[model samples]
Target chain A: MVGVRVDGTTRLMGIIGDPISQARTPQAINPIFAGKGADIVCVPLHVPADDLATVWAGLKAMPNLIGFGVTLPHKQIVPQLCDSLDPLAARIGAVNVVRREPDGRFRGYQFDGQGFVRGLIAQGVVLQGRDALMIGAGGAAVAIAFALQQAGIARLVVANRTFDKAEALARAVNEATGTSFATAGAPTPESGQLVVNATSLGLNDSDPLPLDVSMLQAGMTVAEVIAKPEITALLRAAEQRGAAIHSGIHMITGQVSLIADHMIAALG
Target chain B: MVGVRVDGTTRLMGIIGDPISQARTPQAINPIFAGKGADIVCVPLHVPADDLATVWAGLKAMPNLIGFGVTLPHKQIVPQLCDSLDPLAARIGAVNVVRREPDGRFRGYQFDGQGFVRGLIAQGVVLQGRDALMIGAGGAAVAIAFALQQAGIARLVVANRTFDKAEALARAVNEATGTSFATAGAPTPESGQLVVNATSLGLNDSDPLPLDVSMLQAGMTVAEVIAKPEITALLRAAEQRGAAIHSGIHMITGQVSLIADHMIAALG
Candidate 1:
């Protein structure tokens, strides 16, 4: 079987999350490491919420540790642990990746939003002049909102179960992008050319779709952030409505190459 | 091209040492993990002396981390960090391995000495009725002395640059084994049927032999603990004298299987 060859000198990177067993970065990224002939292996570290700070401190002090991928409860909290943050990650108040600089400083970056945008672009969806309706204002949603704005989306509507959070996310995205392109409102498929499900709503089989499928129109593109069920209810509904659909797996697979690049550059 | 396959769920084991790039445990033990179908990988961790406590504490907190191998400067210090130690390791005041228990407690064990005895036995050398003359009273020497006593060696003579340390090691061995089987003395090939160079004397090409080569006899067995050169100057001299000789590689190769067994058992 083609796989990573770990030895004494192999560089180490890890993904930190409470429930780390299901993390897919190892399989996704290790093959890339093997293909590139990079002597690095990414492992999953189960760091509980309470032990996050301690574990993060420990990992940073390791001389051979190159970087880390942050997820779930860690993404939002890890930005505080970094020595510096990418402007996007700083504005979003979350970090999905931490790379150790050549001078040993740990710098954080958020890849979720960028990954989502890349996935959409890879699927031939044009974001430059399109409007987007984003559901959920949580960590993933915040990242996707900023990334969409950065990708030159003409306008964005942030909708959430809590209107205040959506408003706050919209404000943050607009302030960071220096544009009045984002507004908080209820999701309407007819109002935007792109629809995104950025919440945990589609994780369960019986969970309701994040947005109304009846509003979906042909030529519109829909995407979901939940990867376990690649075709979430929201995506399935959009697909049935004759809209171009992008599954959650694309978001993860899209980031693998970019993350690998960041990690290799950081190794220097 | 055969190597360990690492994934997110692979249990992590590390070897802690200052200069860890040359450590061979990753190559030796990882193959064992793969062969046994154990989802485990041993990696080399370059943990400096100052960062040992912080790094070790962090590693222990990782829920999936099973155990570690302590080498060089960390060996003696690591035993103090363990919740409990194997009886032999406790007596020798050093630990070479630490295994996490099912209840999450970390216990340490010293495999160096045991590995040496096993290597000799594997080579068909009889230890039960043999007398040994060991050079050096450092960490490796102390372990070998204790293991030789435990292996039913008839007697032991420890020689070192500093006589007090050798005396102390001999005393510890006798006290721990409840027998007057070991003594501190000058290096003499005539004193014991088996002569061991446990010191770092043969590490350089220009260094003198640990003992007088002319003193070696045809029926004697000579062993060295240095593995890098495989056949050290002492072993070469022993070979020239037509005495039975054991290389330092035996010490490492013999321990690989035993260490693999301990690590797998600790996964429980």
Candidate 2:
């Protein structure tokens, strides 16, 4: 490339996705990025699922390329290719983070759970000695639920439209950590301590919310993992009812740092 | 990857090379990158010759990928893939550029000759009515000679260890552009106009410079394409004898802006 001035001294990182522009990797990491004295900057790269292998290989061979964030389709695929996979990543059955170490090895880690825990802690949302209702058993749901347990949230109910996935996730977490979990339907603030929505139902203006929050108790806290519409239908509804709401911005912000740290840790 | 701040508005460009970093795409671009009001960043990617077809097809499919710079093996391949090629690009036997049109189509062009020409012009070194001697008949040699002719250089003697390639470059430029080209075996100040070392000589510290300037002419200018040393031995020797000397830096600077313009034009 003519005017593009890359060299061995230039650091490289990227987010690989079919549609790369929608990602928030830039803004969320900006604060810590400025503080870290990092000579690197991450950029977005579009790699369709079908061409993922070839593009991934092409990226790895780049003399200036250090590592990349595996997005969407590549996330699941990366775990199998990595030199090592963090236990939590293997347990969650997905990899939303990947990096190339200084020794030139690619490592995969999942930071969704860790980011959720850190974000919650930052907001002073107490998890210890509390009961949590995790709505939706998909990627983010399982991650949040597992991280809550790690943070000492003693009681958790994993719920989903398809109860099997929720039950499976609960079983996987419970078996892995010996922390007993219960399966429940959509939660009520009366008994559920921390009310979280991991479903895609409230993403758009037209979609219905996961559950009616009018009945939610006044003290019940709410969180949604839908980052695009920072305040999802459920979050907005909870806000109207005067409940504490944690927008997905926290989780998104927490991920880049957590992942960067993991990548650095992996290198050592 | 860290501190990368790509958002929906980021203007995108890419550098295409197998071992990409050796070429300085990012450094050259960053210096002139500010004040554009656009998030213009060029990312480096390695695409090998064998996988270029499919990988390039995938790259074209990216909606945000505005333009790309080609290097090494890809320099010649763009002509075959492009719908049309700039006549100069075809004559030079390679393309170092592929720009996106506003209509989303890409066109191919070559800038090596123009870069060398601009390098000469920028230094205020006159070429009009000057005779020249260029060593090596490779791509860079041909490009520099063509540029020398375009700058109104009157006579040229191309000397290469294997003179056939030099002869071919000379014949092609002459037939294609109607430029006068002449060849000679030995370097003599009486016949020297400008002496350039275009071969892959003078790379390492121990490597002998291809051209000896013991009989250097004061009126002649000396130049070379090898960038690593910044001061090639031939250029140093020529400078000591009062001949004007230009390094690869000016050539690189001259070429970078054209590549950026091509990329922006490609984006349409």
Candidate 3:
């Protein structure tokens, strides 16, 4: 029977995305807000892509609106609306979190990469001087690649169903990191110390594993960025192969705490 | 340590007003939502007057937004944005509640007057064929005057510091009721079975009483519409003179259930 105790003075926060009914941020962060005794509740707001700018403008005008979480279609667009972006988010070309500064300016940051990296680190997986292979060149893939590069990974390979997208993401990462570490490659689990599934393939029960998990080896780390069905087929296969497995829930759980901290500090 | 349990699917309700820090609607209604086993949370939104149109447009586009409560500066303006208004709200020219119909249309309603009348009835004060004196010609007073007329009150005398405003309101009420039962008068407790203070005078501790409570008789019923502090000097003085006293909380308590019911039905 414990419920959210929101009143006139409770500060406002929301997660904005198209088809927002599937978002888990509210359930993840609201409980944290309660635990911290923060008078804030984050709700899901269904802001279609066409209405993103208009809705964002209106939300910014609200004096009690503390901040918001950005997801899906809007993530790449939100960075353009921010007054400033964290260097990492700028490099990734997307934003997953927006904080309203005390001076009333909005600053955007991407937490997907940080969340993934945190989850890996929590499982005792080291990225520094390691070779990592990322599957997909979509939004999540790009963020994780940049985060891995930033974490000092010695080499990074991006594989995609569309080779052009993988090459483009590799170029972006290489240019941003000032290194020749990132390259486009076909899906493989044979040579990397870290393997990541950053695609939507693992979301459905019938969806194929994003990569060749049959080649997974002991001591190698496997990670997923998809949240639904926390233990994806990829993770299960990696687990059975004696590979250290990181489920999508770890990324969400890790990001929730970081995002909450960033939002609270921004409110100050 | 109980906190609001909000997930992506939780329905949203908000109180829209300027200077929203003092509103009690969220505290009153959110608990009721929990009691009803509804996954809903009401929050306070400080929407300034200048951004009302833009923000309202954004709000209307939110597919999960159930409804909103309107307050000062917005109450009179919200009905214009709604697709329809309840007849009582249309006549009162103000709306305190709005519900989003299943057809995606918003309907406006005013519960203040009904709440006051309900409170009066709860205190065993009958309005039918009874003479009533209402102090103030402001928003609350106008609504109460119309509600009293609708309840079959034989006569209503509206008194205010500005006689012109009182006279204008009396004209509107009389025209709406198609009867000359309401008139402008000076503040007095001398000749009515029911006397109500619908003005802001009772909000401050040092302000003078809205009416002459010295003339209150044992058979008279006295009521105040200010919710804070519950009891006002006028009600205290009336109580001392053995008059039936109705505190402001009764109006709020009486309306909470009614408003909750309206919002829930609107969600369907």
lDDT of candidates 1 onward, in order = 0.86, 0.72, 0.85
* lDDT of predicted model 3: 0.85
List residue ranges in candidate 1 displaced over 4 A: A161-164, B161-165, B190-192, B215-218
Q: How much does candidate 2 score in TM-score? A: 0.81
Residue B229, candidate 3: alpha-carbon lDDT: 77
Compared with the true structure, what per-residue lDDT tens digits does model 2 show for residues B1-268? 2123355346667778776657577657644444334466776666677867765665666656777788877887778987667777777768787776677676677888788778777888777887777888888887777787887888878888886776777787777676556654554555447777788888877887686668776777787777778997877888898887888778887888667655654443
State each candidate's clash count: 0, 15, 2
All candidates in order of TM-score, best leading: 1, 3, 2
Q: lDDT tens digits, residues A154-203, model 3?
A: 88889999999999999988888788878999888755478888999989
lDDT of candidate 3 over B117-171, digit per residue (tens): 8777776777889898888998888888888887788888899899999999999
Tens digits of lDDT, candidate 1, B117-219:
8888899887888888999999889889988988888989999999999999888888877899999998987734899999999999999888989989788
Range of the 10 consecutive residues with the lowest summed lDDT in candidate 2 chain A: A1-10
- Per-residue error at B15 for model 2, in Å? 3.8
CA error at residue A136 for candidate 3, angstroms: 2.5
Clashing pairs in 1: none
